[model samples]
Target: MAGERDGETLKRRGLMLVLSSPSGAGKTTISRALLQEDHNLVMSVSATTRPPRPGEIEGKDYFFVEPVDFNLMINRGELLEHAKVFNHYYGTPKGPVDAALAEGRDVLFDIDWQGTQQLAHKARADLVSVFILPPSTAALEQRLKTRAQDSAEVIASRMSKAAEEISHWSEYDYVVVNDDLERCLAEVKAILTAERVRRTRRIGLIDFVSGLRQGY
Candidate 1:
């Protein structure tokens, strides 16, 4: 439906669809679901100084780089946003994102509040940010424990940080509570569908309207 046409084909400028949430709040799950369903949406692969895990392909999972190279990219303004987490640097490369948007392909960003703020400051018109929240703090903690990926100490740290993360909910354009996964996914999809058709986003609407006027 994104490139659908009634008379003259309508073209839209691709938007940066950002989904940010504290750990275990369902942002990753929702992002995966959206990418699977939407052919035009692609995840923005980031460059990281961290080593890849088993079966992780370079340029696919991430562009694994050396710390020196990462620093060079940052210095050269090639990175759209960069952050240090747990002694590793991760960043979004500006080139790929710019190319994707220019070609009318939406780029999905699974980043934090810091990255979202940086993106908003750089490209406010092209950004559509959503913050996901858990139904309750208890639920959030449970979800983190169920993953079993972290130690109790790490989980505790994450739970402590979640509150501070949730405090930034007002900064996002939309907020969805992940009480029910299916319902939340549907609501997010609806938001994307509506955003795609917005008059301002549809870049070709003016030309289409002009054609109609000429016919009249």
Candidate 2:
């Protein structure tokens, strides 16, 4: 918690830190770095139809589900946000996210602009959205190509999409240019520190302050 602390009391609400970017913009890497650095934060694991890669465990990387089950979640309003990506439906399940926030734990999101917008509308008070941009178009193209799975055509498609995605940068509370990974991570860490200290999140502060004044 980043706010004022009186005596040995705990205050402050949990935060939803959303990091959004186009495919090659390094949001995922930055999110992982943030999690490693902060013990109080955890990544919001998404449920997807996408298959797990070689080393990824079922629940650890993502909650792999069949299309029917995913649609069931969507229909039942069990998903906080859902979107179709590259023919697969992916979403954040409402249960775990709600439970984590209620426990005063910060949750991180690596999602697209659409998902970000949904989260904002659903939990505006708890949301802190950040958009990440690569230094240049050429750099973004190169980064996309670095992945062997994507063809040149796919990379080009992603690059084109990146332009559209970056246009929504104004919607976010913070924008970070990922020219260097370490420096970008440091900036994100600072934002988290500042958000934790926000007065609205610290619900226990007023009572704590009053007790302090009374010399309790």
Candidate 3:
């Protein structure tokens, strides 16, 4: 298959693209847009102890493991990052992500700041984290209401949590205020494209340059 650039297929290590945001800040929507558009990117399926809600599939949405099995995974060091949120355990399994990276396919993480930190600690070179922010607190609250995914009580709780989540914006490599969806998405794609061509990630460049020197 052709690589990121057209025609020439130069090998490069894949990246871990992390998009984090408060519940109503549009990270999930941005993530979905990225996955739909980028063939090289795949979402990292997480294992969670939380029960599946309406229209959620077993392996696709989440692994949906029992708490016992999740603990076992933690003990075995099979999870890259694990955290308890809203009384349920959620974690990223290590195996699939590793395989995808090795094959030059980027893995996208729709995880929190805590999980982003863990991934960075484990593989700093491969991680490119972006924190998405809403335009305003009132806009964020309205978005939660518009989505109608959560009850009024739940939306209130999320609004309370948004401030804390937004505080971690400095931790990410890039920050995007998602006031305009198209602009935000374009900026994200620009970031990804630039990161892909960085010298460290382009391992095949060594051989390509060597060939050029020989020809000269």
Point out where model 1 deviates above 4 Å: 1-9
Count of residue pairs whose backbone atoms collide, per candidate: 0, 2, 0
Give the per-residue lDDT of model 3 (tens digit) for 94-164: 99999998888899998898999999898899999999999999999999999988999999999998888
| lDDT (C-alpha, whole model) for all candidates | 0.91, 0.87, 0.91
Candidate 2: which stretches are off by over 4 Å? 1-8, 50-55, 147-149
C-alpha TM-score for every candidate: 0.93, 0.88, 0.90
Tens-digit lDDT track of model 2 for 53-168: 89988877899999999999988989989999889988999898888887789999888788999998888999999999899888888888887779888888888788889999
- Pairs in steric clash, model 3: none
TM-score-best of 1 and 3? 1
Which is the winner by TM-score between candidate 2 and candidate 3?
A: 3
Q: Would you list the rank order by TM-score, best first?
A: 1, 3, 2
Model 2: residue 8 alpha-carbon error in angstroms: 5.4
lDDT of 3: 0.91
Q: Candidate 2, residue 98: CA error in Å?
A: 1.6
105-191: candidate 1 lDDT, tens digit per residue = 899999999999999988998899999999999999999999999999999999999999999999999999999999999999998
The lDDT leader among the candidates is 1
